[model samples]
Target: MPAPNAWVLTEGHAGMESQAVGLAEALGLTPEPRRLRARLPWDWLPGRLWPVPLMGVTTEQGPLAPPWPGVAISCGNVSAPVCAALRRRGVKAVHVQHPKMDPAAFDAVVAAVHDGITGPNVIVTRNALHRATPERLAAARAEWMPRFAHLPRPLVAVLVGGTNGRFRLDGEVGADVAERLAGMMERDKVGLYVTPSRRTGEDAKRALADRLVPLGAEIWDMQGENPYFGLLACADAIVVTCDSVSMMSEAVASSVPVFILDLPGKSRRIGEFIDMLVRDGRVRRFDGRLETWPVTPLDDTPAAAAEVKRRLGL
Candidate 1:
């Protein structure tokens, strides 16, 4: 018998693509491996108004067939309509994150706890799903270890995220966080592996680099030579800014004690998630010092995949 064919739709964004790919891997499904193009005429519009295509568009040209997949999963706001369209055609659709419309429309909605959504079909998780396979981690360790071998032990991984919603991660904040991190590094005599996301502004990146350069720390931008998973796998401890849910989720998933850099006037969603982690003793807030805490690795992807399989009777 042939392996089950899954038509995975990864419109344009990297985060969406990652989630789709991760879900496909977890479900043991082989994706068609063809990119799907989505046309957004109103993407340039300001004030949060977006117009997206409802049907799946071929990466090259033309529209895809209705009921294109045994199952369809979407991660971002833009792909929700497409998934809904697939659901209308009897395709099993699972929506991840907060879709623009009513989530009840989807066959299954895997929402984070911070989204404040609860329902029978909705599986509320504390963090977004991520899969760090052993092969992937091994590759990261092999590739990144030798390059930084001469550096100090107990390396600190600083994962910087850009501004979103009410949380603004500006240059000033990066500078302040970097100052505190540098102090910790000085006391511990450990090297720093700094990685910045696309949302991280050029000014913030410059500020972090400026402060850490004088301290003899290594900095890696998203456009830099190293892949991000390598930094995450090889780091001793991770310090993540409170701006990104996905980043924090991946860090905690690594089974490392994650330290969150507190942001001023953070959004309630961010605050709620952080509070849950603290209450569970999964993470701690960095207060200008190196503190130790115990953490348990969370593997939500496997449970989510199993649930999806059971729902679809796969």
Candidate 2:
């Protein structure tokens, strides 16, 4: 169970919510998740637009007035004002990611190195926080191991992400990715287990599937239960897209060898992060060659959580 006086707040964004929850669990807290929704035009404003409660949340879920909490973990720009408000009331507020507001507003801010945010209360990490602990992965492996038993040995997991502000997955890049995977299947004699994210459009998924399925690859089309964590658990190796730093981070954190596929983009942050990983031998770039090597799983979630706990004197 979580600490009675600790709460995790987010705008319900999946990535940010995961970070908050990961931190909460790291601190030995289960956390009561609080979702904040902005009221109309106020949602259009930036996180640092104004230093007030520009949004509103439903009161029907629980009593609006608070007895207040001793600790609050926040993520995303949408919850920046909430963290500020909590801090003003003497709550030990911990924020994840780069909030648009000043870092001084919170007791501690956990951000990624590529975000390039700096402040007295800031702690930087190489990867995003996630829920992919060894225990969870083991459970997922137990459940999914039988399901994938028919596939060949040396199963390669493909984690696909899609278009973002800085990158695209439409035409040339998609074709190139499919070709590379196909080449690997032909040469390496390994099986493939592919999963595409929500950001990955249907057309792009079909293109990749069309190329790989004939070669004995399986693609989870988001129909029933997701095999995401299961793939992370049982994969002999991982190939992930570069568009999502969060996804890449989670994959690299696992014991399996990780291969990052480059996309067409100008994201200096992602580039810098990948370079660091390559230098540290934590991961490799996919160049139509699939090689396996052992590496001390690259993870920073626990480190960030430890810092947050220290700051709060926990």
Show where candidate 1 strays beyond 4 Å: 1-11, 31-67, 223-225
For candidate 2, write residues 53-103 as lDDT tens digits: 623433224522477677888887777777777788878899888887889
Clashing residue pairs for model 1: none
Question: What is the TM-score of candidate 1?
Answer: 0.85
Q: What would you estimate as the lDDT of candidate 1?
A: 0.74
| Cα TM-score of candidate 2 | 0.91
The regions of model 2 sitting more than 4 angstroms off are 1-6, 54-67
Q: 1-314 in candidate 1: lDDT tens per residue?
A: 66676656656555556666667778888755335555554344421243334532455435676537788777776566677777878888887777767777787887788888877788777777665655677788899888778667787888888777778878888788778888888887778889887778888888889988788787875565755788777877889988777778778877677889876556888789889888888888977666666667765877887887887788
Residue pairs in collision within model 2: 2-30
Query: Which ten residues in a row are the worst by lDDT in model 1?
Result: 43-52
Q: Note the Cα lDDT for every prediction shown.
A: 0.74, 0.84
Can you give the lDDT of residue 177 in candidate 1? 75
